[model samples]
Target chain A: MNILVLVKQVPDSEALVQVKGEGSGVEVEDRYTLNFFDSLAVEEALQIKEQTGAGTVTVLSLGGQKAIEALRTAIAMGAAEAVLLEDPAFENGDEYATAKALAAAAKGMEWDMILCGKEAFDDSSGIVGPLLAEFLGIPLVTTVVKLDFISEEQAVVVEREIEGGKEVIKAPLPVLLSAQKGLNEPRVASVMGVMKAMQTEIKKLDLAAVGLSQSEVGKAGSKEEILRYHRPPERPPVTMIQGEATEVVRQVVALLKDEAKIL
Target chain B: MAGDVWVFAEYQAGKIRKTSLEVLSKGRELAEQLGSGLGVLLLGSGVDGLAQELTAYADTVYYGDNPLLEKYNNDVYYQIIAALAEKEKPHILLAGATFLARDLFPRLAGRLKTGIAVDCLSLEMGDDGSLIARRPLFGGKVLADVVCREGRPQIALVRPNTFSLPDVQSPAQGKVLPLDVTVDTSQVKLEVLDVTRMAKERLDLTEAEIIVTGGRGMKGAENFQLLDDLADVLGATVGATRGVVDNGWRTHDDQVGKSGKTVSPKLYFAVGLSGAIHHVMGMNTSKVVVAINKDPQAPIFQYADYGVLGDLFEIVPLLTETLKKEI
Candidate 1:
């Protein structure tokens, strides 16, 4: 089994994001890390390779310089190779265009399975994975929580979440799966692994290297144009209801009825 | 670009989901604005009954009936929806951002080579007849307005409670129209083996009008019963903070935070949890926030509209009792 995982660098969940006054974009905190679900994806791929003991695990990410850190982190975890798809032309692409470039990259390599984070922390679109599957003409089963080998080279059965329930499904090889939360507990890299990752050269590929064009990726290739970003309406100060428990409860309820009028 | 507005009316566990109706209500408003017809797409086996319910809102109900579509098979549903979009060429396609829609609509848009916005907070008609969808990013801290400059049927998946349920039309106008869909069994790849419903089915947080959430101060897993009792009185759902869920006091499914689900309930009751930024990110979209913590300085008070300082045990039951009488 040849396993390839797609990872992304995103603002840390705890990172404070402030919308700029010009409405161009928000100024995000400098903190960045591998997306939570993508870490699970990388972990699941490494575990699959470890269990099969045959196929190689390669981690791939599409971003600027910071994306390499995500790849290095994945490599430190256990991936054998890393590829960074970075180029000015590939920047600001929507899910459709991003999938187009990633599919081109996948065509340049040989892999039996592809795994991606269910959604990124920054965008949370959850569209790129399925779009990549469609672009590759492969079947996709998303939000997968469990996987079992039916045949090492042929097929696998997976369990995915649904509304108030879960569904167990089977899919053939050369398929794409999006890792949901609870898939597995990710492991931290050892000091040796981190040192080895830093020494290893990260392969960088531009749009041309992936056989993509300027009009086929990034903002040019994007279908939806983001006009601007703005902060949500500011909330009011809290009305503290002090005194006895009963009195405080009464005040809160009365405020909910009179002021908020939501009850 | 004169075309009709299409809505994917999702039927789950035998009834049309309320979120579908919510989207349809908004779709109706959009259709009226564009001076176009409104239609609903129903895909399932023996769903004519559900289609009838949809007619109260939509003008035409287009349903595709097949055993293969009995349970949502991704490939089959995608093929049929794409084929319909190809044939009908509707101006806009709307769906409720349920788990299934979130899983399928983006894939359909890719196949159709169109633009789509998910988890949209609001949808507006641009001057150029394009779809302007404003959606939250980086959780609910910021909002971005997006538009599809060039796309046949602009697609959007709206969050569940963003729009109110429409009043049922006195005389239902929708007429059921069976779509032409041929399922090539050979083309279908994935096969579902089994589906298990949850033992205790609570109101989905995204759709709940009110949520009463407990935190570390709830004490333990058993103490969640207080939240449930409050929720019962308020006709709300129960949710938990990350601390409570991480401590195994509640399942991750019941969790609301940066790591869990984002909710926009009309009224939110915060019990004993510090107003951590991660937790606030998920529920700050709420209309009215009520925080009950012993510590007045807890961070949640900053975001909450009303804060009741007291022990949760004494306060929760008393509040429930007080509301039971006042309401």
Candidate 2:
């Protein structure tokens, strides 16, 4: 059995992001980390490989040099191999174009399952996984919180988080699942795993190698163009209520009805 | 196709979702501005009655009533919607950014070879006659304006509650057209075994009038009972930051943040939680924010409309008791 995991490098969740100039673009802080949800995908894939006792895990990422960091992090978590899809033409690609590039890279690969983060932190667009599944012509279940293989390499049962509840879905093997938080607690990489990750050679693939032309990847192939970027307008000032807890409570109850008027 | 603006009227259990109605209301304005007709694509089983309700906001209603589409099967819905878009060729297609639409729209976009802007906060027409979608990015630190420049039938998923519902002037003078589309069940690779409805009586965070959220400061899973008590008295929904959800104190459905659901409740309470930007992005649009924390410098206080520097364990119960007595 084999599993493929998709990883993305993003600024730490706590990092400060600012819009550059009027509406040109954004200037994210230099600090970068593995997207929080992608770590869960790597952890789940590793656990599946361990439970099956005989499966290889390959982690793939799409970005510049920083994306290699995310792949290495997945390697430190026990993935056997890593692939980085990078090229100048892949820049400015939207969710659809990104999924197309990933699908092209995964075509004909030997794998029984594919996993990805429910959404990327930077863009917050949770569209890639489903779009990738469509591009690869496979079934996909998003926001998966619990997953268990029913028949080793045949099928798996997953619990997907929905609006008001969860849906228990069963799909055949070779399906794509997007990992949500609470699936598992990802383990920190040990010294030995970190050393192994440092030594692992990351394979690089471009659009041409993935059988995609310049017109089929990146900004050229993207459906949406970013017109501008700007900061959200400042909100109204907060009114702080100071004093004893009971006093504050009484004042707030009054304010809720008198000022905000919701009560 | 280029002269019509389309909205996907999502329905369930013989009723239309509020977000779908919100989209239709916004789509009506866009259609009027562009001098085009407003059309709604209603898909489900026995949805002919619900389709009539949409006539108040749409100039034409396209009803696709079939048993196969009763439940949202991703593969089946994608095929049906994509085929409809191909045949009708609407200028823009709009849908609410619900879980079902979030999963369905991207695949539909891929199949139609179009671009989609998801969870957009605002939508407008560009000077060049393109669709402009403004959405929060980088955890709400920046708002990016996006446009589908080259795609036909530009698709957008607007966040719920972002737009107000237009008043129904009168029963719209529109025609309901029945769509004929065939779906092959064999192509579906995933099967729904069962759906377990948890928190059936609780309000959904996105649609709630008031929300009480806890964070890592709430301590343990059992401590959430305090939030529940307060929520009950206020008739509000309970939400958690990603930190609390990751700590296993709450399910993802109750999470409010960038990775979680964005809510615009009239009143929001941030108890025992530091205001992280990711968490703030989810509820910053809330009408009134009230924060209660021991730490006066908690980031949540900055975005909150009312700040109470105290222990939530003490203040929450007191507030709940007071509200229970007063209201």
Candidate 3:
């Protein structure tokens, strides 16, 4: 089995985001890290490879030099190889363009399964995996919390999260699954793994190599344009109650009854 | 190509979802402003009866009743919706940013080569007659106004609980148009084996009128019983912070945070939660918030309407008991 994992580099979730003045755009911070959900995707791939014992895990990312760090991080976590889709033409692309480019590059690879994070933290557009599956002409199951290869080479059963519960789905081989949180705990990179990752040569591909022209993969291909960004208005100031636990509880009950009137 | 504003009326188990009604209400406003008709695309098995309910807000109801669409098959729904958009040429398309819509709309946008703004908090018409969608990004740290600059159908997924339903004035004399489309079964490669509701069967946090959430300070899974007691008394739902969910104390569906489900209930209780921004992002839109924690410095207090600095194990029970008596 050959498993391919799609990875993305994003700002650490804890990092503060600063919007540029007049909504020109968001300022790019230097504190870049592997997107939290994607790390879970890498771990799932590694575990699948370990269980199969005959497959290689390949990590693929689309970005600039910063994204290589994400790929290396995945490599250090036990992925066998890394591929970076890098090119100037890929800049300022929307989720559709991004998925198109990813599908283009993936069409050349031979793999049984493709995995990605349920959504990227930056855009919060959980579009790519499904869109990629559509572009690749494969089946996709998003928000997968549990995955098991029922037939090894032919089919996989997955538990996907839904509104109030979960759905048990089965898809044939050559399917795409987007990893949601709680799928599995990601393993920490070992010292040996890190050393091995440093020596591994990361492969880079551009628009031409991915079989797409400049106009089909970047801003020209994007259908949406960002007009501006602004900080959401702040909520009203909180009214604090200070006292012993019982006293505070009594005060809260009184306030709810008299002030808010929800009681 | 500018035409009617269309809303995808999502339904499950033969009833239309509340979020779809909310979108219809909002779409009616936009359609009136644009001097265009408000239409609803209702698709399901034997859904003609339910399609009539949409007449309160829509001017045209497009009903596509098919057994193949009884359950949502992403490919089939995408194909039908995309085909409708191609022929009808809607100016604006809206759906609730639901699990179903989130899974379907993006694929449709890709197939149609259009832009989509997901989880939008608000929508309006831009000066150039384009749809302006304001969406929260960076985990609610900033709101970005987005537009489908040159796309014919501006697609948007409206966040649930963000808009109120308009009052029913009179039964609208709307036209019911049957959607003629085909489903290619060979295109669908995935099969649904089964769907099981979570064991707890509690109210979903997103739609709950009141939510009481615990954090790591709750200690363990067993300690959540205190929150359950409070929620039962208040007729509320129970939720957890990401830390508690990460600790395996609760299901991910119970998590209230950026990565979890965003909820805006009428009232919220942050019990024993330290108030991380990730958790706050999900509940900050709540109408009234009350925080209870041992530490006075818990960040959640900043977003709460009322705060009680105390031990939740003590305060929660006391509050529940007092509320029980008061009610």
Top DockQ prediction, candidate number: 1
On the 0 to 100 scale, the lDDT of residue B323 in model 1 is: 85
Model 3 chain B lowest lDDT segment of ten: B195-204
Candidate 1, DockQ to 2 decimals?
0.77
lDDT head-to-head 2 vs 3, winner: 2
Two-chain DockQ for model 3: 0.70
Candidate 1 chain A lDDT trough over 10 residues, lowest sum: A147-156
> Candidate 3, residue A239: CA error in Å?
1.2
Clashing pairs in 1: B275-B300
Candidate 3: segments with Cα more than 4 A from true spot: A244-247, A250-263, B199-202, B325-327
Tens-place lDDT digits, model 1, residues A1-263: 89989999998878889989888978999999989999999999988888888888898889887899999999999889899898999988888889889999999987999999888988888999999998898889888889886664489899887766788988998789998877888899989889989988888889889988899899889899999898888888778888888778778877788878877
Residue-by-residue lDDT tens digits, candidate 2, B1-327: 556999998875466887888898899889988889999998888887888887877888998888777666777888888888888889989999887888788888878888899888899998776889998887777899999977778999998878877667485777788889588778887788887666456667876778999999899999999999999988999999998887778987899987788898888999999998878888888888999999988989899888998988899999999999998
Interface RMSD of each: 1.4, 1.8, 1.8
Maximum-TM-score candidate = 1
Per-residue lDDT of B1-327 in model 3, one digit per residue for the tens? 248899999875566777888898899899989999888998888888887877767888898888777777676788898888998899999998888888888878877778899989899898778999999888777889989976778899988878887666485667788887597778878888887766553557876788999999999999999999988888899999999987999988899987898887889999888999778878877888999888988888888889887778778888889888888
lDDT of candidate 1 over B1-327, digit per residue (tens): 139999998876788888998999999999999999999999999887888888899999999886778888898898898888898899999998887888888888889898889989999998877889999898777899999876779999998888989879879988889877797777788888888877755668878899999999999999898888888888898999989988999877788877777888999999999989879978988888989899978999999888888899999989888988987
Share of real contacts kept by model 1? Answer: 0.82
Q: Worst 10-residue stretch by lDDT in candidate 1 chain B?
A: B197-206
Can you write out model 2's per-residue Cα lDDT over A1-263, one digit (the tens) per residue? 69999999998877788888887978888889898889999999999888888889999999998899999998988899999999999998988888889999999477889999988888889888888988998988888999999764499999888788778888998899998876888889988899999999999998788998999889888888898998887877878898888899999999989988879
